[model samples]
Target: MAAGGEPVRLIMSGAVVGQELAAEFGPLPPAMLPVGVQKLYELQLEALGGTRQHLVLPEGYGLTDYDRERLARAGVEVAPIPEGLRLGEAVVYALNSIGAGEGPVHILHGDTLIAEPPLHADDVIVGARRSNEYAWAEIETDASGRITVLVDTRAGEEGREHQPVAAGYFSFSSGVELLRSLTRMRGDFIAGVNHYAAGRPMRALGGGRWLDFGHLQTFFQSRLAVTTARAFNTVRIDGLTARKSSRDEAKIWAEAHWLQEAPPAVQVYCARLLGFGAEAGRSFYETEYEYLPVLSELFVHGALARQPWLRILASCEAFLRTCAQLSGGGSGDAALKALAADKTAARLEAFARETGFDIDAALSLEGRPAPSLRAIAERLVPAYDLQSGAADSVCHGDFCFSNILYDSRVRRIRAIDPRGLVGERPTLYGDVRYDLAKLAHSIVGRYDQIIAGRCRAERRGADFSIAFEPIACQPWLEAALGEMNVRGVRGRSVPVQAVTVSLFLSMIPLHADKPERQMAFIANALRLFLELDSQ
Candidate 1:
């Protein structure tokens, strides 16, 4: 009933359905199936009548042993092919061994699933769907449907309307001739079809349902579809329904999993904040950080209030957790302490090596009496230490105006965009002063220009009070730190005053324009540091 004469039908083995089909149609003469999956092939033999003649390729000689044994048992001839010969070559060899001898041999991929019985031997049947439905091929059938030209322009510019439809089925007139034709071609055998089709007439078969189950997603979907179809008497309706249901479930599951596994807010904030590096693709980590300000603004503006508090908390916790993880050695408290120590000198030393700075000279300047930057930094360090050491808990790394989200109407403070999580170290975790200093930086930094511009436009007058007063920020910082049990420094107007001064001074070199401001900042920082060191 199948092609190639001698009542022989060749089914490529190795894929999911190959073995099953082979066994079901057996007893005529078992042809050795491809060796892809042995169990499935054995199952196919059992399914078939078990009497089919199978032409087996040699073991490791291009065809697998499983197919060869099965075919040999079925009284089919076993042909040994060259080890490296391709699938098309092996198919041609098998056909030649079966007395089909060359000419046009139909080669089919092992994986294609067919729903109907194969066409007659003389007729070349190609699986085709509506052009709009599949869109893979440019098909145009002739009027009589007798002479069909399936053009495969996968390689050339021969822009034919139709492509050689990819159903795992083909029929060749002569096995040896087909094998020789394919052997001489530089391209793969399927590609050789284009040249073979040049003089031969090919026909297309429409009205059959087929599917490709190559990728994991597609494979699962196809398996589910097949299972559902087998269970239901009417496969058409049930298969479609199963596909839709599975796809929907997959999407929901994916979303839920993503939400559950979402990272911390701080990590997100940092990623967005940093954006992408010039050398790499968009840095997801940096993007999250960079976008924190926007997220905070949204929250403060009540855009995110509609979200559940649990969600907000989860995001915040994720950020803190991430920072703790990156702190190195797993000691969150130690990381905070080190950060608060203002070990910028050591960090700068390392940076100097990378940037070709005079590391020796910079270290020499440390503790050495000097004017300009060194003198001011030394003076400011002690003042900073006094204020910083008085805090009840660690504040957000840069809890400034930009990082704070506040509701003016409710007067509620919502801090977002945490840069790092500090551990409960007495020295580093004590104080609202560091936070206050950061707040000062935020106000006095570039935002001042924006506020000025806005004030000029409103004519309501830009007052520092609208943003934050230095005095008002102090209480807020103190209250925040107090809530965490930070003890205020005794007899000090503001806790961590020296630390704040040092912090402000550090910003001078990075921020100030005028020489006077720069000099003033350096002098204050040097004084604070020196005083703190002495203490």
Candidate 2:
């Protein structure tokens, strides 16, 4: 930017994101997933000095009110990228529309993850590679690192001359001069840079934690990278107030302790990832959410149309069906099994507190005879298709009332904080029944009441018991039961028992900071285990 001149930045997010990545998370539009813990779009802004530049995104790519508000919070403007324009033209169009006025315009790919962006006043498009694989734009650079021969092809062979890569990211004095050469550009970032490189050569810089969001494999790889970080960003104790919904008619809240816990790249993907994992893989569980105008809000005000049971059920159905249709079907059984066999009980004990029962004692019951968890798993394994994720199974890894948003007046509901996968792995269709079990836990286990402090628990040595208020969300309970058919779910209601038990274990993280809740959760797990074993 010139002295005393305003700065503008354009991010070309209109280019549809990878289909595989979208399918995993279900109907997620481009630039929605995270690179580390932050959303791709946010990553761009963060990389480009967030809130400093007047930001703009491409139009015609329909955005949700939630998305708009999120961007608007940081001074971003949206503009239309003319139809049938190339990537080059889109940048130019955004520049003209943004009207930053005679200053440098920085352009970035909406989905690219730039970790250590070394921003400078130079014409360059940069990316890195793993042993020269999947180069977006094959670049041959001179000893001085100035790009010499550039072609957007991965064909033929490779050598030191054709180094680094151009990963849909660049800096232009202004895209104005590159427009005429971009008449037919479509989705190609290097094409526009190549056009401008006719006279002024654009260099290729590599290295740093740069990840190309070019495909599904890379996307998941990025997700795992965040997960595997030794110094990963974990949950922090923040007193931040909750945000209101896009409609402004409700509030969205979560445990401040559990919110914003993911690595910087994927942190905004959801409220929080499962800092605690169980017998299921290290898949993301209930991230956290609190919907205001909560059911209690409407109930207290007398504006409730009726109990939101049906709407909640309908919302669950809609969410599951979408996951099923979007899923293709695949299982990381070996990975899943290894992932599920968590040996981190000792670590969790730190977060747990003494209650009616010992969490350690409850945990020791795993693979034991009295609890006979093996038998419960035997019955649930086939029913839930946990191992294979067969063609018909798709799950909402965490399906419960806490993750739901409901409007009593309109009788509408929306589910939030999904696992986004059956077990957070690849699948055309994951275990559909998986969601059924989770939803059932809320209804049968009286999970919502427990969270709301309406349950009682007692423990005597090896035996544990819980007394929950008779469910009041009868409509929702019955409808969800009918949908998942968990009433006769397994002989002797074994599936419900087993699923509820799993939920008991899964919920440890929600109450990680509370000893009483942790013991209650563990006791419930034991109670459910005993119930399943006997019946």
- Top candidate on lDDT is 2
What does the lDDT read for residue 423 in candidate 2? Answer: 33
Q: Each prediction's Cα lDDT score? A: 0.37, 0.48
lDDT by residue for model 1 (427-520), tens = 2122344554454333333232222121111111111111221222234333332233222322222334444544543444343234334333
Per-residue lDDT over 1-535 for candidate 2, one digit per residue giving the tens place of the 0 to 100 score: 3342434556666555544444333233346553332456666676666443543344455554545676787777766565556566566666666655544556667667677664665466665664335545667777887777566656345544535666656665544545444544543556656666766666766536776655655664454434321121222221232221221111112222223332232232234433433222221223433222232212111112233445545655655555555333455333223122221232234334433233433233333434323333333443333454344433445556555555434445544444433233332232444456566666655555555444666545555456654433445554546555321233124434455565566556556455566556656666566655565
Worst 10 residues of 1 by lDDT: 455-464
User: Where does candidate 2 stray beyond 4 Å?
Assistant: 1-6, 22-29, 34-38, 52-60, 82-84, 130-135, 155-162, 179-191, 228-437, 440-482, 487-535
Q: What is the lDDT of residue 1 in candidate 2?
A: 36
When summed lDDT is taken over every stretch of 10 residues in candidate 2, the lowest stretch is: 244-253
